[model samples]
Target: MNAEREIRGSYWLETAPGGAPAPPPAGDVSVDVAVVGGGIAGLSTAWELARRGREVAVLEADRIAAGVTGHTTAKLTVLHTLVYDHLRRTRGREGARLYADSQSAALRRAAEVVADLGIDCDWEEAVAHTYAEAPEHVEALRAEAEAAREAGLPAEFVTGTELPYPVAGAVRVTGQAQFHPVKYLRALTDDLKRHGGTVYEGTRVTGLTEGEPCVLETDTGVSVQAREVVVATHYPIFDRALLFTRLSPRRELVVAGPIDADRAPRDMYITTEQNTRSVRSAPHADGTRLLVVTGEHFTPGAPGAADVEERFARLTAWAQSRFPGLTPTHRWATQDNDSTDSVPLVGRLHPGSRHTYVATGFGGWGLSGGIMAGRLIADLVEGREPEWAGLYDPRRLASVVREGGTFLKNQAHVAKHFVGDRLPSVTSPAPEDLAPGDGAVLRVDGHQCAVHRDDSGQLHAVSARCTHLGCLVAFNRAERAWECPCHGSRFDPDGRILQGPAVRPLEPREITSH
Candidate 1:
């Protein structure tokens, strides 16, 4: 059970090329641009820069497309859940129109790239829906449809939907597309290489410094000096910019399976209720129609989160309750940072540092957001001012002025956890007391340490303090990893860094046998 618990697959990865030869890691190759991630943003940046005849290199901590892009439902639509109405209320009509234009442009850009490169990704165009499961949300859906149409989107309201269960009403946006995300991203990578770009896998960047050529220090002790840098690794890894305070980390679960052709929804859909129902479909490598469902976000290590195993169980139950015949073939979870305001941060890292740029805080709209960020980052590097740059500038404080209360509350929560987690272990379970395949935070040698007992009954221990910001790391029983409560950095039980904000691994501790 433990072996199968966290071994969930993605439909994109299973259908796309599994094993391919990776480019060799070079010692030190300076380029005109060095993109720090290989997902949509990084690859898109490289692709765009290469088109403009600029020398670019992409440094990936993991394999290309293995980050959030691989885990997405792969919808290429601007039809976000209840966003048009909310934006209209907060950002005004013009701001909302700019957002709609950028998102629509992103959708167009993706379609253009697919046609230009002749990529073999399985693409399909379908209408998108934002439906209400509860009665109270019907009016909100209608408002959303009206606002979306006002903002120049092809949106309308309808009482009937293609979902298995009945919905109160839905806002429909036509001409949206969906495809295999990994396959499309893989083509982008191939196009990058063909346009004189270089890529390095397994390269983890640790620190960044301002210089004539900004220096990015990697975990392998290599220095990447670039005229301009784009920190596109999902969450901006830099802490000095204090971007973490403005961004809140969220985790969402996804479960997909082969369902009958008749059972599949004719269009991609989402719900307006608090715990949204994000649904889409794709064909697996064997031509099996896979239905993907994602929603119910929570902070990774927050007390409110379900026990790691329970999260997956709930996801399975959510699917079985809706589509009873689904035989699940893929399951996984993704972490994204939500910005203070609705808009993502996508300009320079800080006011003082013009060379260092970051694109984060997508708030779960990464498929469209990442592509838009890539283009924006490219424009910034070339000194061409994109129209939407002012809205997404990292230093812009309109969001802070409007949403200060929520930001302060979120920071206060962080401050509480930082102090609360270090005080003492309320539940101290000894190493010998833990069963095989279990873990806990306990007082080890008077120190609060994360201890995991393997199947062999051997204890593995590491400092519970998160390397990113000192928040206590909680044991994620589902993935058998330690996850930071505040910033969403993750580490293996053996103390190796699994994800970041934290490039450094957790400090190893000596565990005396009991």
Candidate 2:
């Protein structure tokens, strides 16, 4: 079978000790709270609601964490790439402080959740590091540290003697944390089941009907009736009229491999480079593990590997140059929604959609934001006002718009794709042009089409144009599927829709060889 055809595969949570894939929702059911998308966010929210004595049910298109959660680097930290100063300047000092406070509280709350549940997920309290190898960016690091201090974060600046290399400074966040995301989630999911929460995998939510009692419909001919709904799908499962245009999608890469424990920094670290490098180590069954990674602000359908194979190769070479005899073992990549503003959007879907709530735009730090979103969303579900509600409201002006970049940058992307498709093809690709495990866009009879060659050398072809807006879709090596660089509509290699904004699959383009 073609790899792209087989959606079933391994997820970290599904591989955990004594872990079982969440069963699909069978037939119809009614529950007080119907949670859509069984990732960390959904599971976390369901568990929280269940513990509070609510009848909760979760529905997922695949196993838990099989989506973005399965592909995360699992770095649990408050330092999310030079965000403090940026937030301070844009959203104000109070906004920055609140953002920092929310993340810190989430970190502490995660520790408490792990301990209270006694989940053996390799949980540990590790220091977090934000460094700059470029001397020019050292002041940015210093300013971030100052902002962190102002935000009430326990952060300090370090330089020279502190780093394995470089002349600039670094910010060390003490008492930050790290863990095996799937393992920790496994424990929490089990508790959710025990608390009368229902979890269903392989259940895809197709559309939502808004009313006093909202209805969530699944493609499997099952419907969930609930007073409240939580869409924890990495991207909002449905479109928000205006918010959709505000947040842009960013793709990232993460590679895990062997490292010399004696030489690697004891803490996890990230830098201030444009396509930044994040260094982190976790205790695996073998020894200390290293995640050499890159990728930020990538257009979804753009040409590239999600893991930034080139960047990872460079970072690994640098690592081995400094600390020899280490190699990468496991590698993967994922994309997350980056909102116009740095903060996530967590609240009612829109002003009038009172019964439905959504948690999205974690950027890349979905762990902390996921926890915080679960808390805030659950509060809204229970008819209670949450302290962090205003900070994460989706209705707020986008950071870019507020800062005067949204109009130009967004128009640039739209116009570039809209007109760029008119340009000539780089090359006219034949069906035989693609080797096994390869895919490309080809001009077939004056029309562009997407073609994929499976490992078995079977060629599958579909319309290259995205149904949503006619933008060309690109092959995503990380997800092993076709994605739209414009609006992030994703389809399986065979052209079946996996995500939306594009409601139809690309029609198969018949191939005729010369």
Candidate 3:
């Protein structure tokens, strides 16, 4: 079976119905605190602030919980794949301990909220594993298990798992979890409203002016004035801190399908091999459970359509071979930012900012990291410092120096795309050469134009240069969107913005038939 044809949209989004749309702010709005980006981080932070009796408003560019959070595999585990050992080496044992403690606390906080709010989000407690199929990597797994145990986790090296395949070694950490992220966040949004918090959908914050009362300018020409602002737009739309330099964007594909409850793995699993494979199961309808498999890490637009389709094909093949009779019903992609130091940056937006805070660089583990960020930002807003705040502070220079190699590497990669993408191409495709349901970057007249042909044979043309930073955008045929190889900004074939970093839509370009 072709993975591309068998795949649909996100399972979570298709299953969970969206709530009534909240209208955008009419004109000027005032709130004690404004949380931007209504994913898990924004809503979680808004709810926390509301519970503390602070008037808050959540501004979402799109629907709440319908962005990255919606597409996530929804693993709420403190055991991020192979992170403890790296942290223990780069940071000291105490720093590693703090990292574990903070993430575990976030899990507890989520549990407490679930219980308190009575959210029926199909929450399930399970162990998590980081396994190595190769014997050569067994020692690395053992070291990770030991490091995790030293960091105050119930972790141990094991050679057995419920997975059908055999593993040379695995680091199993208990007390981890998986849940329906959308349901939980929707309930949290409702509860936030109950506590006098406001939410606005279709409101994209475009500019920020920091002051005693920071002002947020939106695309709708409305302004939001707040004492404190949290920029949780996943990739941090505002890069005043030069966060783009330290953060590397990665996009991963996911394929999920229903499996017999008895056949499903009892716990979550991740392996760094094969790009990166993360597996987990969620409660589904009837007697079946949805088995979610995610892998194929690539920079957005770096891979061609054929490459992406091959990746999906490979992932589907792996899942089917491991678990017989499992067919993927859904396939989607999620993007994340990895910090240079491998730790999430969850503090002040910039070094000079007094009221703005940003949360980003979760690598691929944003479920737990976002929750932790919500709590950490809330504490900082309340003028109370969280004990683990120092570890995730965006202002930390020591870690940046220690991880300079990664920082420079990411910059070098981006520089290559930024500079190399500008040189005129010797063999640019012509718009007429594009077949139906295909796209290509063509030099129309003297400019690079992203041109696509619809299934009906109609041609659509847009400027190839990304609005974010002038990097040339490439066509992603698998998703039918133009994505920036640098920074991951995505746009529709019709020149509309699908994701950002880039608030503005792509410019329409005219292409006359030759």
**Candidate No. with top TM-score:** 3
Worst ten-residue run, lDDT, model 1? 18-27
**Candidate 2 structure quality by residue, lDDT tens digits, 349-465:** 887787888888898899988888788788888888766678888776555567557546765786688799768788886878787777788887888989888878788889988
Task: Using TM-score as the measure, name the better of candidate 1 and candidate 2.
Answer: 1
Q: lDDT per residue, candidate 3, 1-514, as tens digits?
A: 5445666889888887676899998889999999999998888889999999999999999999888999999999998888999999999899999999999999999999999999999999999999989999999999999999999999999999988899989999998888999999999999999999999999999999999899999999999999999999988888789988888888899999999999999799999998888888998879999999999888888745337778888998999998899988899999898999999999999889889999999998899999999999999998999889999999999999999999999998889988988899999877778987788889878999999998778899999999999998888888889999888899999988888889888999888753
Clashing pairs in 1: none
Clashing residue pairs in candidate 2 are 257-329, 301-485, 340-399, 341-399
Q: How large an RMSD does model 1 have?
A: 1.8
The better candidate by lDDT, 2 or 3, is 3
Judged by whole-model lDDT over C-alpha atoms, candidate 2 comes out at 0.76
- lDDT of all the models against the reference? 0.84, 0.76, 0.91
lDDT of 1 by residue, 126-160 (tens): 89998987888788888999999989999999999
Better of 1 and 3 by TM-score: 3
Model 3 lDDT-worst window of ten = 301-310
Q: Candidate 1, which segments miss by more than 4 Å at Cα? A: 1-7, 18-24, 272-274, 285-287
